[model samples]
Target: MAAGAPRIFVSHLAGVAVFDPNGDQVARVRDLVVMLRVGRRPPRLLGLVAEVATRRRIFLPMTRVTGIQSGQVLTTGVLNVRRFEQRPTERLVFGELLDRRVTLTETGEEVTVLDLSVQQLPARRDWEIDRVFVRKGRGGAFRRSKGETLTVEWSAVTGFSLEEHGQGAENLLATFEQLRPADLANVLHHLSAKRRAEVAAALDDDRLADVLEELPEDDQIEILGKLAEERAADVLEAMDPDDAADLLGELPEQDKERLLSLMKPADAADMRRLMAYEEHTAGGLMTTEPIVLRPDATVADALARIRNPDLSPAHAAQIYVCRPPDETPTGKYLGTVHFQRLLRDPPYTLVGSIIDDDLQPLAPDAALPVVAGFFATYDMVAAPVVDESGSLLGAVTVDDVLDHMLPDDWRETEYDLDGTDDGTDGTADDRRDGTADEGTDERADDGTDGEVRADGA
Candidate 1:
């Protein structure tokens, strides 16, 4: 190939041997993995790929590969085989955790494989193996098998070097570790509802709870229905009480009753109480768990309490400036202090001074429409849900409001410019009938049509 000339498709580079400058076959091209450019640009090359023998596929930078020719392609720089690790692709199985497979990487001794997560990102057709986590190991073949596990982060993938793994594999597959609940939820939302249910079904109860808490109420219901009732009950138990209530509220009457009956009595009671309140109302929306501190508690003490897992995520975000231990918090529900602000502000500053009077809160029984409007008006991501007595409840995030505010087909219609008018009139008929105005075309003045009417008049 001539210098600076674009490389033409040199026969699908699958299974071709990738050679370093030294002529040793360093790795095999598994697949031609293309990394699409993100943001405003369409998909562009991030790099090429070659899978070395092992669990990991090595990343060959686009600039490094000198030529693509018949039978084999050549990579310019001397290859260091010790860089990328190899392992089996992570797979999701029912009743199992994603981070079970611990694999040996080139650099790290051993890392936990969290998920075999796949993400087809926005504005791109191909799925990108987004991240590989090496957080920890619980159980898997590694638990009994003899080998060390190492960690390989998504950031560590230098580039993808393509190889033909088999004779006629139809699709390209990249193995990845398990994803966090938040990540799983985001991925599921991008997929079809049916597929979302399938993926959810594969998660164990604990993992399911994590994923469920992250999903929208509608999705949560659909996924719960797909799970066995006993399994669903177990998942509900693992979820935050407020989140569990939210899901239960969306379930069919019969299913809801069955799941709740299966739930532990204590958890069931809490959910029942929360469910009794209207969905949009403060009571319905409020999280029962909050880190309550008496007005007298020191700022240090308040910070310590904020770390408590017992406190809901919503509660942790806002430290309630209230009378502690009393269920009946007085009109004394003066204001709120953000945990971030609390940490940065002077410790000696009384909680009263730190309390933001502007803290917007909603009362239980407050209409959904009203609360929805409040979120918009305030530009609030989340707001405290409160009761008639001004007691703390759960919080509502702007994300929670999105499904309600958007039309059912919003996602389908959002990027749909296919049927849009191209700034021209509707159709040929419409243009002809003058319903749509085509610009007036004035004939050029050639002076050929000039006629003189004798001024007989």
Candidate 2:
């Protein structure tokens, strides 16, 4: 649903048909999975438990859902066929919350939950339970017997959140909800193997995909191996194509093939194409998804695309002007329009008119040193990689180049907020190197530069 759309009551969604982009019915929603917070904070609406034609229930993550309107749920056409398993952190809205008694903070009167309303947070994809529909007197959801009924803000009720003493991965995650993916990856790296797996399993696919991209190669392989193959594929699909390809390339041939087969054909093809390149080449380092504008696109169009919150700073630094086919391996390489140039132009000015074609584009097979040199010489955060045929392939971001150049264990190193080394050796082999006890905190010193540092524990 779009941000600021009308709230959807949970009761209305029961058994609603779910369709793919093609409008073919895929399943019917059986329940909604939510995670309760620590206080009266509204619970996050996770996703849906949907039943297919086979009567088997599966988990449909919200990230895959594109629309929920006209009594139908729309999906991205990518579904993980594995049966849904309830995690410790999840609560079924229909199964566990309805008809339950919760006390109102004002009157100290108990009310029975009849229905709940969920609203998508503005400017973000996350949805949360925002209002409670309840009866003032005792009555079951089916029973007509009831006193005054009314809808109240979620914070008016007092029985939903987890207990203060509760011990679980969910609590740990909530406590560190603000941590960057790299910092969280560091915490997970120092955790016991069992704890790491538990936390990984509890995280939603999108968040897990982000954290996995920052984790060490061994950690990434181990965590991916432990997940169900169907879910592994889903997480892989959620990741950036280049990172996904790199991870898949590390797997055994049979295992890699199996995961690739489970993914959507288009995504799988991107993986295959990326994996075909040498690990350190431009083709391997470049992200298939970038802001590609056609020759006729206006500065307004390019600016709007660059404004997408999902785009990394590096990717948004410029727009690649191409031919008719705008997708990567586009019709023909035109020229680039830097972000600064877009700002200087009129809103309706054509991007193609002001393109900077003086600098040559990097070749797909450009070596790591050559690619790095291009960035250093031009002082560019990103550069386009074009094939010999003059078709725009993809753009190599400087961060990816740095990730490849850094020591294999650089992610494991510990540095203080002031950019100085701590007294202890910067290694994670001990599994307790820089944790809460050491008063250490990790922060992204420079997100575009891919620099992270510890903040005095």
- For model 1, residues 96-204, the per-residue Cα lDDT tens digits are 2232333333544334343323233444322334444444333332133333443344445322222211111001111212444654564455444654665566555
Stretches of candidate 1 above 4 Å error? 1-183, 186-204, 214-219, 226-228, 305-315, 326-332, 348-353, 357-360, 376-379, 408-457
User: How well does each candidate superpose onto the true structure, as a TM-score?
Assistant: 0.49, 0.58
> Which one is best on TM-score?
2
Deviation (Å) of 328 in candidate 1: 9.1
Model 1 — TM-score against the truth?
A: 0.49
Clashes of each: 40, 4
